[model samples]
Target chain A: MTVTPDQVLDCSGLACPMPILKTKKAIDSLQIGQILKMTATDPGSKSDIDAWTKKTGHELISYEQAGARYIFYIKKTK
Target chain B: MGETSKRLAIIAAHGSLDAAYPPFILATAAVAMEMECAIFFTFFGLEILKKGYADKLKIAPIGNPAMPVSIPNIVGVLPGMTSMATGMMNGWMRKAHVAKVSELLNIALESGVRFIGCQMTMDVMGYKKEDLIDGIEIGGAASFLEFAGENAITMAF
Candidate 1:
């Protein structure tokens, strides 16, 4: 499948809380309805992003595992 | 849901001297985000909310394998050492511009963050309402469970 990006956030090698923190910052800078593509290597990224999106009312478009990294596509809801 | 507000509850259970930082840091962060935050102090965690105990608490190195070798492992065993260490640590934090426990508590209060003391813990510790600091609401686990319900983020520190 083809992936189109609106914004890219590389959060590899970051620890717990930081990945979420950076993601929030990235999403905050974008306009509503704009997409955010985040790449993280933290093992907790998958669950953290999942929980964060659920809690923050954001939409998770897709999540893919690439080699040792995890990538996510998200849309700003608020 | 049409609400834009964030609500969180931090369960402070570790009565360790240094363990107080988790709830304080997280609560302060919540306040920074303009979120409604609450800290429920249970068991030994209530020590931090005491009038003078917050300034008198210390991080015990006993049973802590991660402690540096220069610091004596038995420092916690010595009487008054905990208070001394707590004082020193507080001073260092001040020098480093880190927020004080009292400051954080005040900030939480000012930001409208609720502070709840665990009734069961207070009973176990032989403390009364007057034994704790002012402005604390006494409640049981069920109360906190209710407060943590309905999508509110809950964390045990």
Candidate 2:
């Protein structure tokens, strides 16, 4: 299944914590049930975003790998 | 995610450019995870609270273990070594596109992490309230201890 995001953020060439930091800010701008698609070049974002989603009660709808980039689709559940 | 609130308190006791990063990193992480975070800057660490100080922070090679190669203590004592080391470290971080110390501080602050300056240190060090960045809560050890005592995690650096 495919899910479209309400907002998209590109964090290419950024390193650990930057990607996570930007993701947090982007997620906060979203309303409940809105989806955010974030693409990051930092490998650490995969786990960081996952943990953040779990911690904040957001829904990690899906994630996909494309070359060195990791793309995450998250829905704001809370 | 509902129950009791989580809080983290950190003591930033050093002022080196490298030493400054850890507290901001931890506080940013905690705030990102939806936990309340506070950082207390004491001793020389209070310098980081001074306006424009983050941009001027330097890593002194004389005692930093994280240097890729060690220089003799006598050599490190040379007048220009600290700036050289700071330049090298800053270059490396920039070459890798890592976020700067100032950027990290901004992130921590914007994330709702409380920044408390040590009032005792401020008095001893001759730092006036106007000398610090805005929104800093100036307090002594007891104030920090109150936050630390209530938190499950506290770290000193």
Q: Please name the candidate that would achieve the greatest lDDT relative to the true structure.
A: 2
Q: Candidate 1: lDDT of B52?
A: 70
Across residues B87-122, which tens digit of lDDT does each residue of candidate 1 receive? 666676666445567766775676577899999888
DockQ of each: 0.04, 0.75
Model 2 CA deviation exceeding 4 Å by range: B1-5
Residue-wise C-alpha lDDT for candidate 1, range A1-78, written one tens digit per residue: 366767999988765545676687788889999999999988878998887787777899899999989999989888
| Candidate 2's DockQ | 0.75
Q: What is the TM-score of candidate 2?
A: 0.93
Chain B TM-scores across candidates? 0.84, 0.93
Clashing pairs in 2: none
Error of 1 at B117 (Å): 0.4
**Docking class of predicted structure 2:** medium
Best by TM-score: 2
